[model samples]
Target: MIGFLNIIVIICIIVFALSMLGMVYRVIKGPTLHDRVITLDAFGVTLMGMMSLVSIVLDTTYLLSVIMLIGMIGFIGTVGFAKFLEKGVIIENDRDNNS
Candidate 1:
């Protein structure tokens, strides 16, 4: 049964990789900036899933931290990109003083 489970995990990993490839293509050829940004976010999620599958196959806990790190980074990047798209800038400086 363990071997069967391993096979299933490997298959899932392969599927995730294929989906990531599709996401990458979308990111490169998407029709709009919003589409590309959404694709990039999906790609990051798929990557994390793939990494977790790898960790399961390897039977190690070392990758758990890496997975969390990836999630945080992906979230931040997506938010930043969205903010940039919405406001035309990621960081705004306030230089006006009326007091």
Candidate 2:
């Protein structure tokens, strides 16, 4: 039943929202930077899922593209943040003596 499926989707989206609320708390009062980073990653993933669920609810596929783009950006950001947190740098310096 299409109606039943829609209900299931709606429930999933609601759950996603509730999870993000907890993540937001972690983001605001986390004791460490790593905890904040984890919360951010969770929040981003939840947003991407919410975008997909919205597209489904609206019977349109346009939001799918946006979802993918946002997901990729989130992944890249997480990687860069982790690298910086670990080593204090993202890109390595080119050591050359020529000036």
Candidate 3:
């Protein structure tokens, strides 16, 4: 049964890798910035999943924290990109408004 589980995990990892490759292609060839940003977000998610799978194969939990860190960074990056796309800047200068 352990062998069966290992095989399944390996298969899943392979599938995730293939999907990540597709996402990379989309990020490079996407028609617009929005498409690229979305693809990047998806790529981050795929990366997290792949890391989790690796942790499973290694029989360790250390990678879980790294996965969460990746998720947080990915979320922040996506939000920053979205804000930039909407407002033309990620961080606005409040000094200009006060003047």
Candidate 4:
């Protein structure tokens, strides 16, 4: 059973690596900001999957915190990029009006 599990994990890692390569290509070759942002988000998701697989193979949960941190960072980055695309900036300049 452990052998079968190992094989599955190895296959998953390979698939994630390939997907990450594709995402990198898109990030580099994409014609628009939105496309690049989407690619980055996809890359982050693939990274998270790979991390999970590694933790599983190692039989340790020590990477859980790292995984969560990566997820949050990815989410925030995506949101910021999306907002930038829509408004040309992530944070509005409310201070300018107050002054």
Alpha carbon lDDT of each predicted model: 0.92, 0.90, 0.96, 0.93
Q: The CA-based lDDT of model 4 is what?
A: 0.93
Q: Rank the candidates by TM-score, best first.
A: 3, 1, 4, 2
lDDT of 2 by residue, 1-99 (tens): 569879999999999989989999999999999989878988999999888898898899889889999999999999999999999999877567455
lDDT digits (tens) for residues 1-99 of candidate 4? 579998999999999999899899999999988899999998998899999999999999999999999999999999999998898988996886966
Candidate 3, position 98, lDDT: 61
N/CA/C clash count, model 3: 0
Residue pairs in clash, model 1 = none
TM agreement with the true structure for every prediction: 0.91, 0.87, 0.92, 0.91
lDDT preference between candidates 2 and 3, better one: 3
Which 10 consecutive positions of candidate 3 have the poorest summed lDDT? 90-99
Q: What is the C-alpha lDDT profile of model 1 across 1-99, one tens digit per residue?
A: 579989999999989988988888898899999999999989888889999899999999999999999999999999999999999999877568555
Residue 51 CA displacement from its true place in model 4, Å: 0.4
Give the alpha carbon lDDT tens digit for every residue of 1-99 in model 3: 569888899999999999999999999999999999999999999999999999999999999999999999999999999999999999987876866
Among these predicted structures, which one has the highest lDDT? 3
Candidate 2 achieves a global lDDT of: 0.90
Clashing pairs in 2: none
